[model samples]
Target: MHGSSSRIVGGDLASVMTREGDKVSLICQTDGKPDPTLTWTKENRNLSNPKQGRKHTHLLTLVREEDAGEYRCRAENPHGSANKTFRLVVQSTPNHMGTMVPLLVGLFLLKVFFCFLLILATFWFSNRQKKAPVMREDTTRG
Candidate 1:
């Protein structure tokens, strides 16, 4: 009969944080007495991987906010199943925001300046179009 046992290879608790749009890999390993079959899952759903072994690495490229979750690696045999959980956190990259703020401010100022010039131009044109008081010259005995 086949039996199994599980032990985390690297650390007791596994966790990683990476910026969005970046690639990350989470490595999970288990030492099994009988060398149980291993599978990886996230949010209780099995994850499809082309490679399977004692040490499995989940590769995520161009990570997004939705990719953040808890991943579970299960090692199972006829005797029983053992599992370990790891956390993956995806964070927004601050570099984009840091550069965006200044660009937005510059655009806003340009808009304001253009609008002020438009109003000034409109006022000048309206006053110019108005006819000045007609000048009258009267030559007569007073």
Candidate 2:
């Protein structure tokens, strides 16, 4: 008797963010004693098969707000069936990371600048300590 099992590969089963007019594909790979058949569904409705293979990728094109919802991928074999769920989130604005790139770069540059300053200071202090002190006459002599 074969048992049906499925697994999500290359991606976590969490909310995926995408913008409008973007292409999105949800990936699912299954392993079973008997090769499991993969099917894609959204909101309990069957979705048109996209890329077909042991690893199924449900292709979503030109995504809109209405296209965002719970997606399920089921792998069924002779024995039993297993499924996994993923969420799609459509954002009106650009990716949050896009706005943060400049900030991150500035912070990185600041860190590099501080590091350079620290190295220069260490070198300067070490070189100063190596130099001998100048001899001075005893001014307190009677």
Candidate 3:
């Protein structure tokens, strides 16, 4: 029986966009009479050891700006071979201070309000104590 040529299960050549520190997966499914060997490359450089077969999916965790580039997946068997290309684009993370500024301001204002209440409570207690002694003296004289 003649073995069928290897082919990608899905159509190839895709562009992937993600922010820095995001996780992404590049898939390369293969179909053939015999299971095909798979390999992956980034910018023409091998991702793993040449002898190792990386089949199906290549996962990237905590993606960085440097990880953005052209990637390729190749499936090969005795009968034939197939290739798929992917272009990864990484975007910068949004400014955190845009949200943090408001949060910080809110916390500062809350602290100031609590301090003002504490000061008023201290003044009231001191005045009450001073009047307590005066009232006791008047009652004693009467």
Best by TM-score: 1
Query: 1 or 3, which is superior by TM-score?
Result: 1
lDDT of 1 by residue, 55-77 (tens): 77778899999999998777665
Q: Looking at model 1, report the run of 10 residues with the lowest lDDT sum.
A: 48-57
Candidate 2: tens digits of C-alpha lDDT, residues 41-119: 8998988653334787778899988989999888776666677888999877567899899999999999999999999
- In what order do the candidates fall by lDDT, top score first? 3, 2, 1
Off by over 4 Å in 3: 50-55, 97-142
Query: Model 2 misses residue 122 by how many Å?
Result: 74
Better candidate number, 1 or 3, judged by lDDT: 3
What TM-score, computed on C-alpha atoms, does each candidate reach? Answer: 0.64, 0.55, 0.63
Q: How far out, in Å, is residue 79 in model 2?
A: 1.9
Clashing pairs in 2: none
Total backbone clashes of model 3? 0
Report the lDDT of model 2 for residue 106. Answer: 99
TM-score of 2: 0.55
